[model samples]
Target: DHFVVLFPILSRNRFSHILKGLAMSGRQITVMLSYPSDEVGNHLMDLDAMYKANLNPHTDVLSRQEFRKLFGYTFKHPFTGLDYIDLYMDLAVDNNIEVVLANDPLAALSYSKDVLVATIHDRKHLKNLLLNNGGNTIIGLDELATKQGKSGGYNPEFGLLGSNLAGNNRLKLFPRDAEQFCYAVQKKLFEKTGKTVEVLVYGDGAFKDPVGKIWELADPVVAPGFTAGLMGTPNEIKMKYIADNELVGLSQEEAQRQLKQKISQKGTNLLGQNASLGTTPRQLTDLLGTLCDLMSGSGDKGTPIIHIQGYFDNYASE
Candidate 1:
């Protein structure tokens, strides 16, 4: 069995219990730490620390693989958290795993039909308008949809009046601002679960307005796949269509070469420091689903199976 641990930088006693539980389950396991080239030794030391800190530590359980190099540093993040690069390197070294998988949102963005909708609401009226229209169209309140009541229902005044009437009529006036609503829900859930939750937003254009601030509260942001006069690039509006709205295509060597050229030429890393964060649950689930599908035939022997337990100071962190 191979246990691949993903972290930015290995921290105190994170996987001590997991190793012990694997041993107790009587599986021959090779541990792989997924991290960066620079931090391999740092994480190995952390693994050593984890063993030392264990209450009933076993010496034979701790081991290290020949450190392998990374392609290059695309993500310039802090030297903490999970090391995904290490995971890939160690897997190739120890068990000779053929496939290296990644489903991180940013990585997946070019491969999935995911729409990032940043919403801004002015006063309560915007919410009412959003709710009535199923929260899709973009419009300004100052702009008239119809002219006075002179043309009856077709008039812009009638459109505004009808909108007002709908607002007063609906029994439950839920806020139409999805960003605010999602943030509120996530905040409450994180408080209840006591789990660290981070969101990374990517966009361009007038994203700096209200919705962009909301995105800032999220973990990080990658701005405009395209830009114009201000930034060299065009924006998602231009490339996303040609790219089929999926980032997987970009990961390919040919596609990456083209995209990188465009980014270097025109795009400015809009979000800046705000872009360093991990994957979201939806993204993780997507990755896991792909893994399950790929490895579904692991009946017993060909695929290594092991049961492991993990312990943390407070909530059981996975």
Candidate 2:
């Protein structure tokens, strides 16, 4: 009655275990959901379907009645085949629960001022946005078990943001001191082998699935920490562009020699250069993380660790 909780649900596993416990609170809970897809790119409905029905995700907000009517019963996910909307709403153990569909963080204020923000990646920003927009009580899910004891399972940094439910109560959180861990691993690798190998702590990669329309980046970031060597974006020229344009009409051997010479004589920074046009202008970690994540697929086919070699090698490298 007093607390008007604002929960933005992602999937079944995100809030299923706590639904009954929240019901006991008897708070006027307002659940906000992003339509077509959640924050992590889990598509709720097909894009064509939404467009055919004359809906704009940017401006339009849908009530429970409208959502059900438009999408029909059991609008299943493309991959999981679970109707996430129906699943979430059905799990509302309490009559106090109310659902709304929107992308705007400020939309929660229309229902209540006192709200509990339940999002993962955008928790801090959303909380701040709510506070700035006249919210009475604003709390992020990450702030839940920040300083709690370890036996009960607690994360001082992420709290419950990147946590998995071990039981009805216990939540296994994302690893802490990621930067320190990388250094430690680097040190251990140096100790074991004479060569100095750079290390990084990578979570889910920033990869999008064309089939499911879901992004693999459900976590906060791809790489939270890495050695000094793995810092900054890749600074390399486009070999294909160089070969086709600059080295055109030359013999194969001559073109190869010219390419090697160009590589040797290239400037340190290659950002916004015509020679680097075809190259991916992104963080090295992001690229590596995507590659590594693909190598070690999640769920059943997952291997806990992936070994990558020669990633830093370029045409310039001997």
Candidate 3:
């Protein structure tokens, strides 16, 4: 049987597991991957070398041999020194595998009609594209664990979308009823202090590292659920612009006090104001979620809940 799997991620364990399963089924698999980098920015080749080679990943469909000849085995990630493409290729032996590098979703149809859509956010769209374009047995990562299992945890809504490896043969699924829990917390806080608080279930940050070029959004979304107070992009003004331009005649200390008053009184009205010129609008949840993610990093801090104070406070506030 011929099966085409659109593989993403650089995890050796996951690669081995998928190959083992496919081999057990006696399926000769063709694993298609995007070039330069995978979907979540796990880069496969040196970006500088790719640019130097004048290879357009948008149009170029590269075989394993072609990629190796051009980039060679010398390209490694700056921080991790991972030769991901070579690693994946080495692991595919004896599994009856042929790896292809292409950007288009329809490219997998050349190898086999039976396709496995393994992307996270692009799974639905990719499945539809494959099915409409001569695909026979199309499945996604989300559908792999939809049903309730007697042994392991399962998310009925998300399925295997937001799962992570806790141990061997064990996964940590996304928290169930996250929206309900957030609402409950908000309600409890309001009743206790008579103040409205926004609560949300956050996973990954919406950010990228300049040095490593690693996009931090491994999860599907930054935040799944948030209170109404956390809805929409933040309307903020540039305090520096106001302090410099608006308070032109004032001295250092006087300008500080005036700036504080101006920011506090500026409120939600910022149309046609020069002070709000360069300020970009970002979603409130994304902003707060990024802050929380940065504060409580993906390390051994063990800090779960983050209490943000003075967020709503102006420069004038004590």
Give Cα-based local distance difference scores for all models.
0.29, 0.75, 0.76
Per-residue lDDT tens digits for candidate 3, residues 135-250, read 99999766766677687666767666666666654566666678888999999999999998879878778889887777777666778788887888756678878767788888
The residue-level lDDT of candidate 3 at 81 comes to 78
- Model 3 compared with the native: what TM-score? 0.82
Candidate 2 or 1, higher lDDT: 2
**Candidate 3 accuracy as lDDT:** 0.76
Candidate 2 local lDDT, residue 43: 72
lDDT (Cα, tens digit) per residue for candidate 2, span 1-318:
645445455655556555545666766666777877777777777788999999988889899889888988656776668876666666565566667788777877887887777777778888898999999889877777778674566667766666555676555566677889989988998998977988887777888888666777755568877888888888788899998889889999999888989988889898889998968778888988788888776677654777789887777678
Off by over 4 Å in 2: 2-9, 18-24, 167-169
Q: In model 1, how large is the Cα lDDT of residue 309?
A: 23
* Candidate with maximal lDDT: 3
The candidate, 1 or 3, that scores higher on TM-score is 3
Candidate 1 residue-wise lDDT, 91-130, digit = tens = 3433333222221212212222221111122213533444
Candidate 2 lowest-lDDT run of ten: 2-11
When superposed on Cα atoms, how far off is each prediction in RMSD? 27.6, 2.5, 3.3
Winning model by TM-score: 2
| Model 1 CA deviation exceeding 4 Å by range | 1-9, 32-182, 185-318
